[model samples]
Target: MNRTLIPLAMALILCLLAATAPAADSHPGWFGVIADPGALTIRNGVAGRLSEYTVAIGDPVRPGQIVARIDPEQAAAQLAQMQAQIDAAEAELEGKKATTNSLQERLERILTRPDALSSGALAEMRGNLRTARAETRAAEARLAQQIQERELTRGKIAKTELRSPIQGHVVEYLANVGADLSTDAAVVRLRSAQPLVLRFAFDPRDAAAPSVGTRIRVQEDRSIGAPGNDTRSHTATVESLAMIVDEDSG
Candidate 1:
């Protein structure tokens, strides 16, 4: 009787301790990370060595902002070369036109003194004037070609810069300064700041969960994101819910 009584007393005490132990309170709704409208991946259309970066992760960005750039040195050199060619061509054209005008004036002056030279000499002067004019025209055509080439070089230079497509914070960086990248390579990722959305799930049995139009506060996960950012929450109303649960998780 004593042994049985002693065992029963110990069992009761253990059961009471277990019952008294506190458990964490469970929230009815599941937690989810806040999402932005969407993320924008900054990329470049040309392949080259990354020259510099204007922003990094957690840095604020705006649409059309110059985020990163590849080495445009080659393109720039080509542009300068093209520009110089255009200038030279233009100068050549001007010089040729001046020569043509001078030749025309001389020919007119020679014609005015018809008795000074024979028909054969006058014909030679007119031929010289025509040749000068032809040369001027050739120079003009050369100048036009150089100008077109310069524009093509300008376009190539533009492709070296990788710009942000959305106003947001920099989220990821796939390439850094001095890194080589292929065409259409991703450089930086930007996320939109305005119009944030929250995605969450709820257990069907958890008393009453949030529904459409239900107001709630979104608490920032201070442990996960940018440091020194405000952990305060913003109020929002639920707009929609998923009708089905994920079978693998459920």
Candidate 2:
């Protein structure tokens, strides 16, 4: 009876020690880093030989700043031709107006002198006046069309000068000076002037409990030499959660 009692007492003590042992603390959740940023791709909108490249990789740029230039010789020639056309049209219009005015003046003089003007002569003067007015109208239309063409050419020429779309850093140059570029050809890559994000992934089972903005702890891989070594833990708020599970991981 005594030996059996000793074994029972030993069993009771062991069970009590096992039950009293401290539980492992719950691991703080892990998350992947996500970068929230924008990238810009600069493109040549005009077709021409690239004349100048004013930006280099890693150069900071501002919006509306000119970063490159295409050859403007063609554009300049086009503008000059349009200007000459406009000048010719204007001169022709002026002549037509002058002729129209002279005819009117003669008709007025003849009408004032009733005996001096025959009915047939007056009818002929009226026909001449109508023709002069028609010529003036046609010349004015031509002038207007020339002006519009000149404006369009000027716009296209302006496009040959490439400008930064956003304030950022240049990441690449796709073409160099003297290179022929086609429309929509990429010229440079730019990174947005904004804060960077770190993207990371977490286990789906553990990810379900957290919502966006939920406070959590993050641990980065130690081998990567991320800042704050020895204190590898960071307090990060959840920004988002993935909706679908990755099938390959299953």
Question: What lDDT tens digits, residue by residue, belong to model 2 across residues 57-126?
Answer: 8888999988889998888899999999999899999999999999999888888888887889888889
TM-score on alpha carbons, each prediction:
0.60, 0.67
lDDT against the true structure, per candidate, is: 0.71, 0.71
> After aligning candidate 1 to the native by TM-score, how far in Å is the CA of 21 from where it should be?
24
lDDT of 1 by residue, 165-234 (tens): 7777888888868988888888887877545667766654456566566555555567565666566445
**Which parts of model 1 are misplaced by more than 4 Å?**
1-37, 194-211, 214-250
The list of candidate 2 runs beyond 4 A from truth reads: 1-37, 195-203, 206-238, 242-250
**Candidate 2 lDDT score relative to the true structure:** 0.71
Give the clashing residue pairs of candidate 1, or none: none
